[model samples]
Target: MSRITLELAKKMIENAEKEANQIGVPMVICVVDEGGNFIACHRMDDAFLVSVDIAQNKAWTAAAMKMSTADLARVAGPGQELYGINTTNNGRIVVFGGGIPLRKIGQIAGAVGVSGGSVEQDVQVAQAAVKIFEDFE
Candidate 1:
């Protein structure tokens, strides 16, 4: 299975943190490998404690599914396709905007997830990390 290096994980987290700081929110950021194994998690000062698990779950869900959680939210909505998916994966799937898969060398490398901000802010933070990962490649 593909994996993310600690260096890359740090870069992703740094970018996510930068976005969170720009948005004026303390965030919990997580990076998970392609197999949904945790690589790193960073909880900023004053970040909501509840967001720690949420961030990790978001990263795991994104890497495992190879899709953004925001996209999942569409299909996983009540009465929609993939409904109850969140309940099936040991309750790990995060059907929201904070999760984004990280692709490297044309394959899934991992994912980054951010929390402690609004959904839009979370998406923005994750996107920043995605861009950094792409540039790192």
Candidate 2:
């Protein structure tokens, strides 16, 4: 399992930024390794100050859990397998669509998180970034 190089993390941020710009939303984007270690974090000029923390938490959650935050949100709801999971990890878990696990050959390498937009727009930006990473070696 290869780690997420700084180069790849930058690429993810660059692409995510483009998407956010096109959507007319400033954004905060973060990437974390499989161990939930920070690889990179970026915030657009007009992005909300609070979004920085949310973006980082989203990436951390996705990486630590080895799953997309969107998926986690599904199972983390009331009466679900991961109920109260958000309360764990000292509240790091975001359980939202903007965080996506980046996989290399079906193995988790890292995760990307985007914020400062609607959840759907954030997911779109994150998905674009992850798609680019998937095509890289």
* True-vs-predicted CA distance for residue 18, candidate 2, Å: 0.7
* lDDT (Cα, tens digit) per residue for candidate 2, span 1-137: 66789998898899889888898999999998888899999999999999999999998888888888899999999999899999987988997789998888789888998889888998999997897788787
> What are the candidates' C-alpha RMSDs?
1.5, 1.0
How well does model 2 score by local distance difference test?
A: 0.89
How many residue pairs collide in each prediction?
0, 0
**How many clashes would you count in candidate 2?**
0
lDDT at 118 for candidate 2?
85
Deviation (Å) of 120 in candidate 2: 0.6
- TM-score top scorer: 2
TM-scores for every predicted model: 0.94, 0.95
- Those runs of model 1 whose alpha carbons end farther than 4 Å from true positions after fitting are 1-3
- Candidate 2 Cα misplacement greater than 4 A, ranges: none
Q: For candidate 2, what's the RMSD?
A: 1.0
Q: lDDT tens string, model 1, 1-137?
A: 33678888898889889888988999999998888888899999999999999988889889889999999999999999899999986898889989999887678888998888899988998898888888874
